[model samples]
Target: MEALVDHVKTLAKSCDAKTRREILDQLQSLCHSIESPDDTVQRISFLNLQLAGLRIGADLKLFNILSESSSPLTIDQISKNTKENAVLLGIHRTLEHSYTLYQEVDKDAFTANNVCKTLATIGAQAAIHHYFDAMGPGIQELPDLLKDTQYADPEDITNTGIQRAWKTDLSLFLWFQEQPEELSHFQHYLTMNRSGRPIFLDVYPVLEKTETNMDPERALFVDVRGGTSHDIQEWKPWHKDFIQPQTAKGAKFYYMRNIMYDWPDDKCRLNLKHLIDAMGPDSFILIDEMVLPNSGVHWQMAQLDMLMMAVLAARERTHEQWSKLLESAGLKINNIYTYADTLKDSIIEAVPL
Candidate 1:
């Protein structure tokens, strides 16, 4: 019996005794030998399925539907209310399977559960609206452009110089200039949340200089594209005793966030000159923007740069590009604070010297 126990212990020891290198070698060999054509095909199919589900979900306003309900509803009920077919609704229901909506249900009937409630609170319907609204005009013209035979050849009249200019920066700039109301609507959507109240409410005391017995010098966040200051009330609670803008001359730091990237060099320079004329020489300008690095490629920045070009005929700037902009704006860079790892975005402090 003792010998049998000893034999059993020996077998266990042998099983546990594989060296790290040996295990790694075995794993490498197994990985090299494995072929996963089935997995590849399944992954592609899964992505396509997700895309189709999203399209159906958007069309049916599933986020908005679930928002109005306190409890989960079946696919048939959702379809009846939304006027969407049950088959498409079922696809979205399945797509939401991993969500909390699926977990609370004893059976799958597209119940509005905790996840759905959370999504509604986050204004997921409004978010979807924003997404589709941004894409609407562009998506409408694609089919017609594709069908036009005149645009088929690379060197054709439809594809060459005049066509290129119309499709490029000039056309977009003209559209924006002509469509002031539409541009204002877009700006309202983008800048609605960025108010002085939101910025200074919870975050103000920390940013204030505690050592000074004098009232904390308020930072002047000059939104260059600062449309009608609609959200100013949100900041009043936090900065209740702060000096009014008209009264506070030179006692504040100015901030321009996400403004300079939308215009050409000449226009940006003109904008900066106007800012400089308003503020004192001692006042600092803090620019919060993505400062593209001199080296190392960032795919997101590159993509955003292209979008800015398409929409505004503008591009994201590098640190050097920013310096040039500042110079053009009659301001000089005092210091630049770049967050490590996220090297694309930075806080650039400048002064009109």
Candidate 2:
């Protein structure tokens, strides 16, 4: 193993990007072979340290301070300029070992690295605040909430782990409305996370090809339960008509993006039923969501699935599960346009029977 690792290092110095990626895969497999139970336990137990350090660093604007500086700054200089305690700034040292966000330059000075630049961004900062301050407690209560008799399975939206942690029966959306800053940050997080990805219009381009004979006055897209239509406005600048309906009405296409995963099976069925009822014989519902794999779920997908379970009493679904849900709502899936690589999210096109 040591000789193989040395060979990999030698290749890494001159390998092409594709070969380097292959080398990384080999290295990861080799590393996994040697990993032990204690290593796993230790890694899991120290997750709080990483999050806690990030929370403190974000609160103190440490990433910005480091990223903007021309050169490395000492702890004393950083503390004096930011007006935050020097000891609290030391918390970022925890991030260096695993995240590669910061690097020590001289003996006591530090500089920002590549990942730190991302952390310094406004959207990333907002996501950090939302996760640490708004959603942290909710995540911490998972064990206790799952054990409680009243929340056994906790499938109901009102009786969720989030409700237990937050001490409110209000739905997650309603709760977000009351927390303005958190809501804004949450929106920014979504935009930042989804940035650089192609919209459904870019991927399918079916709208451009499929001739629409509907009245020009009708909405081009109906973002059901979409709040304020910010994404719609940003995505569709020329055609800005959006409809949020509670009843059946036919349109050319109905696009639902990242909404259904916040609901359980029963509620999802009801929502789909409404969309199904509103569909013309030629109408299609393009549902955007992460379809979890049957086995060996990716880390991001697994984390998101558990997050939905904890916060919304909802879940991400597999392809089979999505098919089952669509069938339950009297709809059949026509096509699934999946993004390239590891992105689990897909555009599932369905039609009413």
Candidate 3:
């Protein structure tokens, strides 16, 4: 028993990302296991309200004000900074009660934690506001949507929860186009690397797989979506391709990170068909996404699956699901190199089937 305890202690202290997440998962499970039925329901129910709190906080610049201050801030001070009467201070109650995002030093007083500071950052604020703008309403509509649809799995992106809430036929991405602020925020949200997981290249031998077959006139790598700064480090000066104005007709390897889960299987198939048409004989596709397991799924994975359903009527797929989807697109999975144990972020390498 002592040895087992010592092993757990070691795992807790260690910097190994996989083990750290395992510890967190177990700790979360422990809480859920012992928690009362009332507490459990309250805990889960509050999650629905979290976006509301975050959105309200962002609008009032509450996180900004709190994060900037070195000392604890009273409600009066916060009110003064915000230039608003009777601040709701929803984030303080919602996030602190749930995630300890802020430090409630005393009654009606708060200080910034690391999480609070991140929330104050532009990207995080963008994520908070942009996501909440649609998601908050979508969540509200979801229960009715499910019941109205007779509890069917939402496979149609056209008439989704977000569309129903917003009262627009435009897809989530297209709707953002009309709102520049939200669109910029959406970009900022995409740019943020808050997941704290290893990139696909770390786990997948992408460089090794594609390096041997190089063509000078032809393109090497084309990143469709704007990638992170991490790309600058992993890929050398010659490797990065921001192919605009014209498509790279025959790229050796086309890489995308966390792109597929945004759309349903039909959309994914349609999306892939366009790409497959652009591929050369030697070309391969790399999809960086989470590959969910059949059982014992992590909460983050499960939560994201719920999120996808709520907004886009899309889903995060399991291996079997992924296989069927890709097979339908006329591509075969060469390998699935998973980079994170907790989220199971993987590089699904596919070539012509």
List candidate 3 segments past 4 Å from native: 1-13, 84-99, 106-109, 194-197, 224-247
Please estimate how well model 2 matches the true structure, expressed as its whole-model Cα lDDT.
0.75
Query: TM per model?
Result: 0.55, 0.85, 0.82
Indicate the residue-level lDDT of 126 in model 1: 38
Per-residue lDDT for 23-73 in model 3, tens only? 877878887999999999998788857777777778888888888898998
Candidate 2 runs further than 4 Å off: 1-32, 91-99, 149-153, 207-209, 212-219, 228-248
Off by over 4 Å in 1: 1-59, 67-71, 91-108, 111-123, 136-223, 228-254, 277-279, 292-303, 337-346
How close to the true structure is residue 143 of candidate 3, measured as C-alpha lDDT?
A: 89
Clashing pairs in 1: 72-111, 72-112, 197-234, 197-235
Give the per-residue lDDT digits (tens) of candidate 2, residues 1-353.
79977887798989765477667766777767788989878877888778778877888888999899999999899889879777765655645536678888886688988788999998899898888877888888888877775556557777666677788989787799898988998989877887776555556767563575667765456666455444456535232122333443666677777788888888888777777777776778889778777786666678888888888888888888899989988998888887633656688988876
Would you list the C-alpha lDDT of every candidate in the order shown?
Answer: 0.53, 0.75, 0.77
99-213, model 1: which lDDT tens digit per residue?
3443335454555555555444324433334334443444334345445644442212122222233354334434546656545545554553342223222232324533443
Worst lDDT 10-window in candidate 1? 237-246
Task: Look at candidate 2 and give me any clashing residue pairs.
Answer: none
Q: lDDT (0-100) at residue 231 of candidate 3?
A: 49
